[model samples]
Target: MILAEELTKILSSDQVTQNLTILQQHSQDESFHEPHLPDVVVFPKSSNDVSRILSFANEHRIPVVPFGAGSGLEGHAIPVQGGITLDFALMNRILEIYPSDFCVKVQPGVTRLQLNKELKKYGLFFSVDPGADATLGGMAATNASGTTAVRYGIMRDQVRDLEVVLADGRTIHTGGQAVKSSSGYHLNGLFTGSEGTLGVFTELTLKVYGIPECVMAARAAFPTVKQALNTATSILTAGIPIAKMELVDSRSILQMNRFQETDYPVMPTLFLEFHGNDNGLEQETAFTRLIAEEQACVDFIYESDSKERKKLWKARHHLSYAFRHGSPGKHIEGTDVCVPLSCLADSIEHARKKMEEADIDGAVIGHIGDGNYHTLLVIDPDDPNDRKKAHEINKAIVEFALQHGGTCTGEHGVGLGKIRYQRTEHGNALDVMMDLKRLLDPNHILNPGKLFPMSSPSTLNIN
Candidate 1:
């Protein structure tokens, strides 16, 4: 009852639960990783509560894992060590909004959709969306990026500062309100994607944007993936300043039709969007249509009405779910590799070819405007061979991407899934990362089995 006694003192009995139901809820994220239930789960209502809990946990050398909405595809939110899972649900609040400064200071549990809904009155919105309605703190933790990343950038770009509760229970603020700063140690960069290993986020000061004056969504179909990827390449080279560009292969298109129950063209397609002032909107649309036609477009469909535009993107956001709906009882292995924009086409082609040769049942969809694509491998999770084949394909895809100056994961942070690739991806630089993790979390009490492997901290090699 020592664990119960301490946590109950910091938070009420209701705030700290040893109930199996709540522990089960915090056991896993939306990943294929093995789940481990924490000994106790604590819901902190404010920064001071979080500070006290972390301080106590640190003193006892107990593992502490911070959990948000549990929407992460990797196992970033899982409490593998099963010590104390700190849930920030009670901290969900939009503390302040500054329209003139174009930013907002918020509690960690605020979500992207919730934030944008409030920002609508002031014509402001948060840009980064990692598909799920993930909490802002979780988004920042993963450096999550989504459809608008090509234009507005990722989670790292959205942050102006963060109120962090370190492993030792000390409170510190990273960065500042300024849009840009050459401050000490670049704590923003250090902790933004640290995945809660260095410190737990208590408050986040994030950048937001004024809503575009006009937005036009279009669906352009091509007879083949090559043609579709080529069109994306041309669009990038053309420098058209479009807002969002996504590529969905025919395989994914078939599933999208099944999932959305819409008979969109059963061909590879690009979901494109353009935003600008009212003056040249039509001209921009016409210009984009012309560019697609030049790249062997089968047909191009446009959505100008705000409601229809939202519907179109909403369907796009649920592509992975669509694929899952079509294939029952199959787990998804996302081959997330991002290369240089110039090499994106090559990278995708390589992935497609590899999947074909392996006869893996999968579909391809991507935020291609920024050179990141995921080959969704939906397979029977119970089959060892299927799992092995999927990993082989993913490893090959990551190797190809790394060779082409790409990363193993673009938007999804490296949790337990991609931990093996760190040595290969970061080279000797990973050593410094391990050193930093050890330095900040001397007891290794923070999210223990993520980012870097704990099996051999000194030896980078892993079997």
Candidate 2:
């Protein structure tokens, strides 16, 4: 057990919360998993403080779970082993804005929406947007990507640099302000999605993009998911540079309509966004319509007005909540899978059939342009049978994706949910990962019991 005197010496009594209720709140994230409360919750206000706390924890061989806002779908921020919960909420601040370089430096606790709001003053915005108002640090740690990832790319792509605190109180800058680099080791890439198992990120320097001159958003409907997916593929094959293309099935549409109090056709639909000047937008829309027609699309409607487009996308953004709203008292379990573009349609169809065979009710949604999709499974948390069926469905979906040359997860990093498939998916690569984990975190004090299963007692030699 960690000594209270040592902790108090590191951080103020006010900064360290010993309350069981507060610790419980910090234990679990938005995942459906049971909570494991940390022994103590430490709110560090600076990089040095974080480093010192980690140094002490490393010396004591105590698990240190770096936490952001705890909005992750996966159990990324949960303190599974129940040690110290390092909350970055107090460190929230925008450190700097390099408008000319198109990058911003910020603390880990700053949310994406908060960063974007500040960036709007300079006509710049960070593009990697997961649906939830997730912290930028949490987003980077998870390597999160959402609808815009089809065009702008993931959090790893947007990150320019990271100020990471290693296990032994060492601070290192992984990347830099330069737009491109052929530097040594590519440590930035290694830590971006490390999910706090490697180190705690104190500050992040992220790449930002200039706001588009003109934007056009559209919704295209089809009688079936096959047609909607096919339309998306056709549009991509036709060389339309769509900024964002998302697939929403009929079930999800009904949920959206009920939750948002707005009516959309209860059919498989594709939400699209085009970013360019007026003429380019017009051409893209025309080309999109032409390609979608080949896939038997029922209708293709475009919204050019900014207000109306925001309203439309807002509804799309609330899809997960809509699923939860539609099924009261049920928890939402979303499966994220990415298949090769050639096999995306088949994969979706296979998953849909499996859900039907199991008599499970869920909705299929996708960042179709990238061949990545999610099936939101709403299940009664109180029912063990329901939970078992959801797991089976998840397993089937993951297996289907792997069979199709796809990853177990698209954007949501391998937290507790996908750990079982690491060996199956990566094969020999898993051995290399184990080596890497040992080399960096020999003590295994950082977010223990996550990302990888516990190593055999004989294999661990922490000294």
For every model in order, what is the number of clashing pairs? 0, 0
In model 1, the Cα lDDT at residue 368 comes to 91
Q: Tell me how far the alpha carbon of residue 219 in candidate 1 is from the true structure, in angstroms, after superposition.
A: 1.0
lDDT of 2 by residue, 301-350 (tens): 89999999999898788888888777888888787889998888788888
* Root-mean-square deviation per candidate: 3.5, 2.6
The CA lDDT at 206 in model 1 is 95
lDDT of 1 by residue, 1-463 (tens): 3687677887889898888999999999988889899888899999999999888887777888999999988899998877888899999999999999999999999999999999999999999978789999999998999899988998998889999998899999998889887757888988999999999999999999989888889999988777887787777777776889998888777887888888889888899998787657788778888888987897898888999998888777787788788788888777587888878767777888888888887777789988899888978899998888888898899999999888999988898899988999999999999999888888788888999876412211111
lDDT of candidates 1 onward, in order: 0.86, 0.87
TM-score winner: 2
Please provide TM-scores, in order, for all candidate models, with all chains considered together: 0.95, 0.96
